[model samples]
Target: MKKLINDPKNVVNEAVAGFEVAHADIVRVSHDPVFIVRADAPLHGKVGIVSGGGSGHEPMHGGFVGFGMLDAAVPGPVFTSPTPDPILAATQAVDGGAGVLHIVKNYTGDVLNFETAADLAAADGIQVRTVIINDDVAVKDSLYTAGRRGVAGTILVEKIAGAAAERGDDLDAVTAVAEKVNSHVRTMGVALTPCVVPHAGEPSFTLADDEIEIGIGIHGEPGRERIKLEPADAIVDRLLGPILEDLPFASGDEVLLLVNGMGGTPQIELYIVFRRAAEVLQECGITVTRSLVGNYTTSLEMAGASISVLKLDDELTALWDAPVQTAALRWGR
Candidate 1:
């Protein structure tokens, strides 16, 4: 309930305004539909990449709108899907005559809304393709999705897909690369605390000081099970075990690792978890070629972390190394 905001209803809009002010050089914000597009959008002849979801996960769909990444990012209210209107506007705003690709998580609302928007845009002469991210190995079916939920692995999809689009790949090509990433990626998370949505005025879920929820969802949804807290090494093992087994990575496999903090976990703890992750992968003969450790995707103020592993091939490796410049991720300018 103790949120730094003038009004709960205005949180998303005000946050978008703040983002525009803080990163005006890189992005431009629009209203009515409420989307943010790359400052130099409609890149002629290049496929436009667009993604959006609930608003609480900052530096996600929006923070990622920029050069070498997304051209447009639409945001909804906290834990809510953006309506079709904004998504359509976003598609139109960034359509440079080539086409547009929608990267959607496997949430029910997200799928429905994005699909409707895509259908609408296609009718309006904008060629649109979609690649859904369902990399969360945490669940096969949940309250929100029929299959696995899309988690931190989404960041990987965005990065690799964005690179493909930035390199002027056609819509089909970009979508293929994105689909490849989604298929090869897997993620799992644990939570020590929960988040309070501005409207709810209370923590969505709660945990004891000595307990933790494994396979925690980004929106504070319950995980698979709860257990007493363990050491970082054991926690990392439990998380990585399922991911590695699910992909069934082979010896000498190269992979990209992401150790993401859920908003409240500090850098020190994230690095601690990363250390164990790296060690565990090494023991399994997996090479951590590219590793990103930070709060790239997050719950509002939850204290926990998620581990994402992407089994990489030559094509994915090259795309992963490709240049990217965004608010949360930047390299090779």
Candidate 2:
């Protein structure tokens, strides 16, 4: 119930307005049915990348719309999947004679809506393709998803694939890179507190002072289980153990590590978890060539953290290092 806003229903509108103004040099916001497109959209001959989901996970589909990242992002209500209209608008806005790629999460509503958008765009003579992200190693089924839910690993996929598109890779090439990241990455999260959707005016879930939800999804989906709170090192181990085991990462394997805060977790604590994650990977002889530590994705004001590990190869690493200028991520520019 405690949040800064004039009206609960207007959170997404207000937030996007502020965001557009703040990052206007890099992005442009279109209203009357909302969508975000890069400041220099419709880059002739470049394949466009579009992605979206519920609104609370900030700096995600929207913040990533510039430079070597997404060209457009459609946002829905808080924790609600967007309908197809804005998505189709985004598709049309970014199409520049080349194709468009839709980077979608595995949530049911999101999957359906994006699929509809792709179909609508195709009917309008625009080539459209999609790559779904289902990297959460937490649960096979959850509240909003049929299979595993997409989580922090999505940022890695967007970065790598967006770079491919920016490098003039065809739609097939861009989609292949995205799928590659999704297949090689694994993520798990633990939540200390659930977030409140502005309209609902209540926490999405509940937990006691000494309890934590392990392997949680970004939208407060049920995780593997809940347990008594543990120390930072223990939590990090629990998050990374399954990831390393699920992927056939042997010694000397190079990987990219993302220690992401789920909105309310502090930077110091995330770094503490990252420190433990780095040590564990070192023990396993996995070399972390790149690491990002911060709130790249978040659940409203939830207090939690997630870990994403991507087994990398030469191509992915190089693309990841490409110049990317955006609201949240910028490097080598």
Candidate 3:
């Protein structure tokens, strides 16, 4: 595996340090390890927003930390959950007088850890609310399992709900918007190649030259199925079919589409995916209201892409269009 880093053990802290130097105006490191809070944090009675997951999905929970997104992000080990201590610290650091909202993905460890942190914060008299994002349509939701893992769609929830909080919406209103976003979004992903975790020092899973795994999770969990490699259009059909059939987004439904790249995919390939995704949406009579493409979230050196669709209403569209300045995404001049 080829990567530019000194040691696997220090990867998270080293990356966070570099991130702080690169985005000094927007983020600051906590006294605790692997936790990054907004430089302008402690929004002083504004509902604090905290989200995190394993490392390697850069520009996610961390890159979203800024003026109108997440207020703090707790980092886990590569593709692992942040333990209870850092998560609790993140909750405490961002909690203004209003409350703190934890945006947790639906992974088992992540869900359990964030849930524990929320409980601990409540014990400290900090109002803590959480919106668990399980937007991945790939996983079968059942009584036994943890449901679908939260994927790229969580970014949309964070953006829209953080906008609500930035406008001085109450904690309940912020949490409500987050829940609303969670309801509107669904995602499915596919992988062309496996990614090598730094510590693992090898690919998490293997894919042959002419094979692709459909319905992949970001962390290299087993996908729904593996199929022979096909052209971009055919690949998109496979990706979008379940999303459309299950969600049944009908004609004239306006939507937001995010074509996200796993770390190793190129922009050219992403655009190829986007081109077909747009065509498929148009053919289905769905209106593509807004679109974002590129590596908003990534697994470490993984060659894959996930398509996330959020059916949008006026409120969601307005919140999505609001100004956002962060290291990974910036808009609204």
| Candidate 3 lDDT over residue span 21-135, tens digit each | 9889889987455689989889897999999989999878899998888999998999889998899998888988999999998878888999898899999999988898988
Clashes in model 3: which pairs?
none
Over the stretch 198-275, how does candidate 2's per-residue lDDT look in tens digits?
A: 888878789999999999889898898899999999989898888888877789999999999999999999999999
The lDDT of each candidate is: 0.93, 0.93, 0.89
Off by over 4 Å in 2: none
Local distance difference test, candidate 1: 0.93
After superposing candidate 1, which stretches have Cα over 4 Å from the reference? none
Query: What lDDT is reached at residue 332 by model 2?
Result: 88
Question: For candidate 1, which ten residues in a row score worst on lDDT?
Answer: 138-147
Q: What is the lDDT of residue 119 in candidate 1?
A: 98
Q: In model 1, which residue pairs have backbone atoms overlapping below 3 Å?
A: none
